[model samples]
Target: MSKESRKFHVPDALANLYDFANTLDLRHFTHHGIQHQQADELHNLAALGEWMRQHGLIERAAAPSQKTFEAALRLRAAVRDYLKCEPAERHRKPAVIGPLNAAMEAFALRVATIGKDGFALRPVTSDAQAGLSAIVAELYDAASAGTLGRLKMCAADECQRVFFDRSKPGTRRWCQSTLCGNREKTRTYRERHRHDPASEV
Candidate 1:
C-alpha cells in the first residue's frame, strides 16, 4: 500500500489514536490548496469515506454519517490546536474538547478473554464519532502521563502536519526535514543574504 494509506497502523511506541484524526495535508503554501486525507484519487467525499474505513478510522459495516464526518474533521482541527499549545495552555479550550467528550462518552470498554499478558482495556464503539472518541481518549491518556511530549506539530510556520518524535533524544523539530524544514531554511537563507552587498552585482 501507499505510504498515506499505511498511516492507519499505530505503532506500539506511538499509541495515541488522535494521530488518525488529522489526516488532511495543509503543506500547500496557497489558499484553497489543501486536501482532505490526501487521497490518491481525486479526494471526492466518497473516496474520503472509503479511505476512512481502509485506515480503520471508521468501521466498514456502518454507513458513514455526514454529521459524523463533519465532526471528525472539526475534531481534527481542535486536536491540532490542543496539541500545539503548552500543557498549561491546553485548559483554555472548552470549544475544542466538547466534541472530544461527546465522542468519548459514546464509546465503552469491553473485557476480552484471557491472554498471556492478562486482560487489556479494549475499546468498543459503533459507527459515527464514537470511534473518533475512543482514539481521542487515548491521546488524552498519553498526554496526561507526559509520554506524549514527543507528539508535535511541525515547527515550520506553514506546515500543519503532526509528527511523532522517535528520536533517541526526543528532540525532533520537524515533521519531515526534507520538506517543510528545508523549505523554511532556504527561505531564511535567501532573506538573510538578500540585503548583503556582496550578493548584488
Candidate 2:
C-alpha cells in the first residue's frame, strides 16, 4: 500500500489495482502557478520491477523481461481506459473492455483456500508475471465484491487520474471537487458568459 493509496483511503483489497492504474499520472493542470508534471512510474522494466517489489507483488530479485514490461504497460493502459468509462458502461463498451480483456489474458489466477472456510485468489505462476497476476486477482476480487465500480478515472480531460469514489451516490465525476471540479465549473461559467453583452461594458 503506497502513501497515495492510504491518503485516498482506498480499501486494501483494491489498493494494488488503484496504484497500478495510476502508474501514469496524466494530470497536467497547473495549480497555484505550478504546473503538474506528468510521470509514469513504470517507465521501464527496472522501474516496473521496483514497483512490483515495493508493492510486495514480487520478490526483490525477480526482474521483469522486456516482453513482461510491454505487457505490463498494456495492462496499465487498458485499466486506465476501462476506468475512464462510467461504471455502468464499463462492461458495455467494447472499445475499452476488449483491450482490457486482451491485456489481462497474460495474467492468470487460481482459487486457493485461505483458512478454515475462506478462499482467496492466488497467482498461478511464481515468476515475474505472477506479480501482474496478483494485480489481476485484485481486480477480479474487487469486481466480485462490487467495489470495482467505485474505482474510476477522473472525468477531467486534463487530469485523468484514477480515484476511488467514496460518495454515497457514487456519481462523482472529478477526483477532487475543490480542484478539478471547480476548475471545470469555472471554465464552463466563463464560456457561458463569454459572448454575453453584459460583460461588454
Candidate 3:
C-alpha cells in the first residue's frame, strides 16, 4: 500500500489498484492563491521502476523497459477513463471498457495458492513488468468481491482524481466533498443567481 492509500483509509486489497490508477495527477485548479501542478509519477522507465519498488511490487534492481513503461501508462489511462463513467453504466460503454481490456493484455496473471481464501491471482512472469500484472490481479479480485464499483473518478473537470467512494449508498460524486464538491455547488449557485435582478448590487 502506498502512503496516499493509507492516508485515505483505502482497503488493503484495493490499495495497489488505487495507487496505480492515481499515478497521474490531473488537478489544475487553484486554491487559496496556489495553483496545483499536474504530475505523472511514471514519467519514464526509471521512475516506473522506482514506483514499483516503493510499493514492493518489484525488486530493488528491476529495471523496466521502454515498452513496459508505455504499457503502464496506457493501463493507467484506460483505468482513469473507465472510472470516469458511472458505475452502473460502465459496462454499457464499450468505448470506455474496450481500451482497458486491450491495455490489460500486455500483462498475464495466474492462480496462486495463497491468501485467506487459499487462492489468489498472481503475475505469471518473473520480470519487472510482472508488477503490472499484480495490479491487474488486484483489479480482478476487487471486481469479484464487488468492491471495484466503489473506485470512482472525481466529477470536477479541473480535478479528475480517482477516489474510493465510501458512502452508504455508494453515490458520492466528488473525491473531496469539502473541496471539489463545494466548488461545484458554489459555481452552480452563482450561475443560477447571476441573472436574478434581486441579487444585483
The model with the greatest TM-score is: 2
Each prediction's total of clashing residue pairs, residues at least 3 apart in sequence or on different chains, is: 0, 0, 0
Give the Cα-based TM-score of candidate 1 against the true structure.
Answer: 0.65
Candidate 1 — which residues are off by over 4 angstroms?
1-10, 13-19, 29-48, 57-59, 86-125, 196-201
Q: Order of candidates by lDDT, top first? A: 2, 3, 1
Per-residue C-alpha lDDT of model 3 across residues 34-91, encoded as one tens digit per residue: 9999999988888899999999989997888999999999999998899899989999
Candidates by TM-score, descending order: 2, 3, 1
How well is each residue in 22-99 modelled by candidate 2, as lDDT tens digits?
A: 999989999999999999999988999999999998888779889889999999999888989899999999899899
Candidate 1 per-residue lDDT over residues 113-188, each given as its tens digit = 5678675335565554455555655675576667666677777777766776667877767877777778789999
The runs of at least 3 residues in candidate 3 whose Cα sits more than 4 Å from the true structure, single-residue gaps closed, are 115-117
TM-score, cand. 3 vs. native: 0.96
Error of 1 at 92 (Å): 6.5
Candidate 2: 10-residue stretch with minimal lDDT: 56-65
